[model samples]
Target: MSNRDYSLSDVVALLVESGDNASTFYRYSDDVPMPSVEVLSEIVEDLRTVLFPGYYGPSEITPDTMPYYIGSTLDRVERHLADQINRGYCFVCDKNKVDRCQDCETRSRNMARAFITKLPEIRELLLSDVEAAYDGDPAAKTHGETIFCYPSIRTMTNHRIAHELYKLGVDIIPRIIGEMAHSDTGIDIHPGATIGRSFFMDHGTGTVIGETCVIGDNVRVYQGVTLGAKSFPKGDDERLIKGLPRHPLVEDDVIIYAGATILGRVTIGKGAVIGGNVWITRDVPAGAQIVQSRAMQQSFSDGGGI
Candidate 1:
């Protein structure tokens, strides 16, 4: 098969040409490989191994070999990340600036180094997450079980690491890292979401935590739960506003259960328990417990919205 252009504008054009109707096959427009996504995943996995030496990749790593291994991994990671960052810079930036793009490569390396320096902090945060999962679920046998097996913990770990890079302004790669976890774990957490400590997820498949969502400490979310946006308000240029908080504010100790979809900028109050398959657009008071009523049958939109 021949290659086709599938840029976002190209896709929009195709849809318009087809009278706003397109098949599932039509939805896929480009076969061009995205190497950056895989490279970002490999870099993150390398860091994960370095962070949890005995648990993630190689258990036999010793102090003697640790420096060599770390140095080697960092070397490989920097090269790959620099290439991706430069490519992304080339994509969204001015064409004239591309020829003189000297600083991006350096900036990418520096960001990678900064992320590496923060591994200890990542591990510390993950410890609490592991503990939270262990305690939150009766089925979780141990902290080891949570670390080794839980999909939510795995997804959250990647998000936490990627979130740091996202905050540090390394464009495009954080989403890649999060997508890597999404592919492996069936959990899609946006890299830009601000998650706090001791977050626990239970049976976390089909959970979509959107960008701009601010989750407070000790929040527990279950399968098919979505902390997402309402309607997107467009600006004067018809472009959706960038960097505004669009998703839900999930407060501390809230337990959002399976298939619950909370949208808009509504606050899910502290200690509230949201039940399965419920659609919530309005704010719930603290200590509120919301359940779905069978009397109200609405079409289930996979992407959560009211």
Candidate 2:
């Protein structure tokens, strides 16, 4: 029945109507190009190679050949990162209805160069993370095994890179980078989260660290743990507010076990230990140990009476 009635002209008309309906979600700016996820994926890998040169890159890396490899890798990173960062800048400008695209090229190049310069710092922090993972897990044989085989290593590496871009005020790309790691590792860490040194995630799958979370040094968390906001505040227009500090602030040396969910902007003081499967919404003092209390049981009569 459809074959007898529909023609190519009718199909073209329907396609036009569909496109019209999709206009609200489409970006129409010709000057602004969306950041490429594929390109960003490659950028993350390249940066990883730089951070752990011999481990991630070619196996032939030696002390004598390190300089040439590093120099060439850095050059490639600069070129690709500048292009992607420029796209990110333009995309944000278009979304915010700002007319700063003219200067974005210069800004992107400068930001990329600045980011490259921070590689040493990033590498230092990542080493701390790797150390934390190795020390926290007794099963880990060596730092190299943890670096190559652990999901936390992959997730944190991506997070550290994305966090740097976020700090530099780059938009969209950070979130994209975060999502890439999330997809690959099953660990979700927001780019805006302020994580400190020696952060460790053991069995990191299903861990969620929300945006605005401030984690201090030597903090460790386990699988299925969530440091998240309890609720969202709505404005007069009923729109959810943005940019508020909503996630928890975890202090140094805190250990949150598996399935522990800490909500809102509560603080977990230094040296505190949160036990598995506990739900916390309030601040816990220093050196405190939080665990779920035992459930009370009631005796019942035989059959149906209580």
Candidate 3:
């Protein structure tokens, strides 16, 4: 071993040199104000309080004070969310060329207000999801329990909020919100996935729903299920094409069991039951049951079959 002395100053200098490299994906200067995860987390908490009322925020909230509490929380959420949205816009803006004169603050405020207006609808969808969870899971005692305790509810709540922001064309912030949920729960759902009402994920861990997936109403899925792409298409320039519908299309009343991997742009028809540990890449007809074939028992001298 060669003896070498390395000071903290030397390490700092090396890091500075690496950061100054133009080939690296580094954000500086105009990207001074990036979307903050801390602020975004606080915004999520405030929004959750607005959505679930007494379940998330203060426990002493009476019906009389509920309206006031919700209003105040919404006001805070709007202000903070608008700021984060503006940062997201600024992060992507070509300040030297296209968006130098863009009114990002105004646009962000308008987007935040638009998201606030849709809270009632988002709550309606969440109510449906809560009910679906209660009805689907025999262990669930009440819909309130699902709202208060279930990771699915929390994850879905974040997804619903993120989905709205994605629809409103706000970038970065939605993904941060989605990732917050994913960090808490093992479920990873892309913000771009379009999901209808009454969706329930039983046990919920390790479930991955990809971008461009369109899931219909009253759909239920178990843990370890993957709704992913089969393959990625590339352009003539050798860069992988994006924004294409590569994920599965799950229809109404479909039930996907645990450990099932449904890949590609395949359509899962209405009322279909996908069995556990099954791998599917093609479209299924309505009212079909897809399951793994029976395992054959064979005698082996070396006990390999066991």
Task: List the RMSD of every prediction in angstroms.
Answer: 7.9, 5.7, 5.3
User: Which digits, one per residue and each the tens of the lDDT, describe model 3 over residues 20-59?
Assistant: 8663446665454878999999999988888898889898
Indicate the worst ten consecutive residues by lDDT in candidate 3: 297-306
The TM-score obtained by model 2 is 0.91
lDDT tens digits, residue span 1-306, model 1: 223647778777766787655443332213222336666767778877766666787888888998888788777876776677655555444423334455766876777677777877888888889989999999988788888889978898899988998888876678788888899988899999999999988889889999999999998888899888889989999999887888999899999889988898998889988888888997777886666654322322222323
Q: Which stretches of candidate 2 lie over 4 Å from their true place?
A: 1-24, 295-306
The candidate with the higher TM-score, 1 or 3, is 3
**Positional deviation of residue 184's Cα in model 1 after best superposition, in angstroms:** 1.5
Misplaced by over 4 Å in model 3 are 1-4, 22-25, 94-98, 294-306
Candidate number with the higher lDDT (1 or 2): 2
Per-residue lDDT of candidate 2, residues 228-299 (tens digit): 999999999999999999999999999999999989989888998988998878777788777665431011
Clashes of each: 1, 0, 0
True-vs-predicted CA distance for residue 57, candidate 3, Å: 0.3
Instruction: Give the lDDT of residue 295 in candidate 1.
Output: 30
The global C-alpha lDDT for each of the candidates, from Candidate 1 onward, is: 0.79, 0.89, 0.88
- The numbered model that scores best in TM-score is 3
